[model samples]
Each structure stands twice: as C-alpha cells, then as structure tokens.
Target: MSLKGVELQIAIPKTFDAGKMADQHHQKTINQQLDANEALNREIERKQLAVNKSEGMDAISEEDENDASNNGQTSSEQNKKKKQQQEQDAQHPFKGNLFDFSG
Candidate 1:
C-alpha cells in the first residue's frame, strides 16, 4: 500500500439548537419594538412643542393688541388734561407768572 493511495474516513454529527434560535428571534423582536416606541415618543414630543409654541405666539400678539389700545386711550386722556391746564392758565394769567426766589 502506498501513502498517496491511503485515505481516512470520519463521521461527524450535525445538530440544530431550536431553543437558542427562538430566544435570539424573540430578543430581536423586543429590540425592534423598543426602537419603534422610542421613535413614536419623539414624534409626539415634537408635535406637542409645536402646539405650545403656537399658543405662546398667540398670547404675545393678544398682549400687543391690548397694549396698543391702552396707548391710544392714554394719549386721549393726556390731550384732555392739557386742555384743562390751558384753560386754567388762561383764567389766572398771573398765578404762575412770578417765580419764588426765596427757595
């Protein structure tokens, strides 16, 4: 018998671990679900922030309008006070004509 013509045969058994595969599949599904939930939460927070920003802008505009109206009223009241002062000055021309030098 020559060494080049000699051959050896060996038997090896193949096995499948079903439980380990199932556990791996289950963990993959759980990770996917967690990722989806995180994405959904981020979307909800973004929409809520947008709504709050819009509401804040609306409140600021309303306050500006009220301030404008109040300013108009204040100007009218100032005009009335000036007219009253002018009438009083006309009635008593010498009331404030002399300055008090004693102070």
Candidate 2:
C-alpha cells in the first residue's frame, strides 16, 4: 500500500535454505575426490603394466644381448632398439580424447 505518492521498499531477504547449500557443498567435494582417485588408479595401472612387461621379457625367445655383438658391438640390439623407437615415435604423442579431423 502506498501513502499519497510515496512508496516503501521492503528489506526482507530472499528465501535462502541453509540445508540445501550444505548438501551441494558436500556433493561437490565428493565428486572432486572421486575424480582424483580415478586419475590415480589409471596412472598406477599403466606403471604396473610397464613393470610386468619388462620383467616378463626375460625368458622370451629373443637374441641375447651378447649374441648380437659385432666387433665388440651389438648390431642386433641397435637395430631392435631403433625399430622399437620408431614404433614408439609412430604412436600418437597424445593421450586421451584425441580427434583427427584431417582425414
């Protein structure tokens, strides 16, 4: 209600609920923790696989390091290492969510 031509503004605050705010904060923290744990798990798994492969290659049927020597040098080791390096270089240097539109 206005008296004459003067108007009055109310100072009432907006209907803010304290419980919902706390719940939202809790959910945000949980999500962040979950994301961090997932990243840690993936990194651990990758490292484990690398360790296993290195250990498991010991008994494999491959040219011995000493057998591939030439003039006290190993040509076979060099060639094999070079080939593996090439394969590694051929791998996309990027990890996760790679998209190549230049087909």
Every model's Cα RMSD, please? Answer: 17.1, 13.0
* lDDT of candidate 2 over 1-103, digit per residue (tens): 5434222222222223456687899999999999999999999998877745464476343436434443465778677876896687578766755789899
Q: Which stretches of candidate 2 lie over 4 Å from their true place?
A: 1-16, 51-103
* TM-score for each predicted model, relative to the true structure: 0.40, 0.37
Error of 1 at 79 (Å): 19
Off by over 4 Å in 1: 1-16, 52-103
Q: Summarize candidate 1's per-residue lDDT along 1-103 as a digit string, tens digits.
A: 4323223221111123566678899999999999999999999998877755467787678757756666757767867865886686478656757888899
Candidate lDDT scores, in order, read 0.70, 0.66
Q: Which whole-number lDDT from 0 to 100 does residue 65 have in model 2?
A: 46
- Candidate that would win on lDDT: 1
